[model samples]
Target: MRRDTRNRLLEAAEGEFTAHGYPRTTVTRIAASAGVSVQTLYLAWGSKRELLRGYLESALAGDAASPEDAITRFTGLSPRERLVELADLVGEIAERAATGWRLYRDASAVDPDIAADWDELQLLRHRLIARVFEDIPATALADGLTPKAAVDTAWTIASPDSHDLLVRRLGYAPGEFRDWMARTLTAAVLAPDSGADTTM
Candidate 1:
């Protein structure tokens, strides 16, 4: 049950982190939430900061799948299908990590190790997605949609953590905005190769 205990600590920590934030959250509170002692938390995760890292990593992991694995999951699809899958994942991740990410990102800025790990993870994600976008069947048709630019642009609309605004504020459902995002990114990235002016 070691894995179970670790997961319990993590879940407890996530809740505490979300409620009190990184600076205010204490290992005692998190352990209390998990029905464990402060020492247990320290032994399990080393320190409060490490516990926070574990929480952030766990939350981030959901959204951190490589673009290729994501595309493969949505398999037997055309380039458009792959593109849609990629966009959908962005929506899923942003929706879930909306709150946790805000804290994780802010906390990382002050901690070199966390910041480095955060940057590396993000860079890996960007490159992986860019590779997929670059290898689309119509790469040569891209007018100016280089893999780098396409990846940047995709991250642009999808990475803003604005899905809630689009839905709750603007009144679009999750699926609606997700569809719009997919279509929009595909157009931008593919229009160049197709010689079509489908940018929005």
Candidate 2:
């Protein structure tokens, strides 16, 4: 099917980008790796940049659920539980995509288009984090912290860059990094006595 072919190409592209990086990866190489013609690859995604964008977008779009279901789930969780959930979820995503992100960072420097896309993805990520904590009461947030500031703190802690530094560079186990994030968010953002302060 058309969808199957596209997915295959995207999957193959991920490996190519991961191994050779964006600048060094080639259409011919990707097509060969995917067992498809170069023309077929181009027809599916237009350009290598578009292919990379598609791959990154798909990979970054975590755990899909309907809006109603997501709201129900978040509302069911206590404030502290929410932070823990976010920490675990973001940690898993970062662990999976950190290497690919390194490639994106390297590619963005010479490619304005990729740089723009990366910026947009970061904004989208921030917006998603805000939505995750939408059900938590404002009083649960740290003293003097605006909702925007709280979200920023959470975003920074959950960021791929933070994961790369703490886990990839410092060799912290994935679970250790996740626990650190939950604890950090609890101390920095959550009110002192909020149930979300479960220690790591």
Q: Mind giving the per-residue lDDT tens digits that candidate 1 earns over 86-112? A: 778776866666666677677787777
Kindly report the root-mean-square deviation of model 2 from the true structure over all alpha carbons.
3.1
Q: Cα miss at 65, model 2 (Å)? A: 5.5
lDDT of each: 0.69, 0.81
Among all candidates shown, the one with the greatest TM-score: 2
RMSD of each: 4.4, 3.1
Cα lDDT tens digits, model 2, 106-130, are 7889899989988887887888788
How many pairs of residues collide in model 2?
1
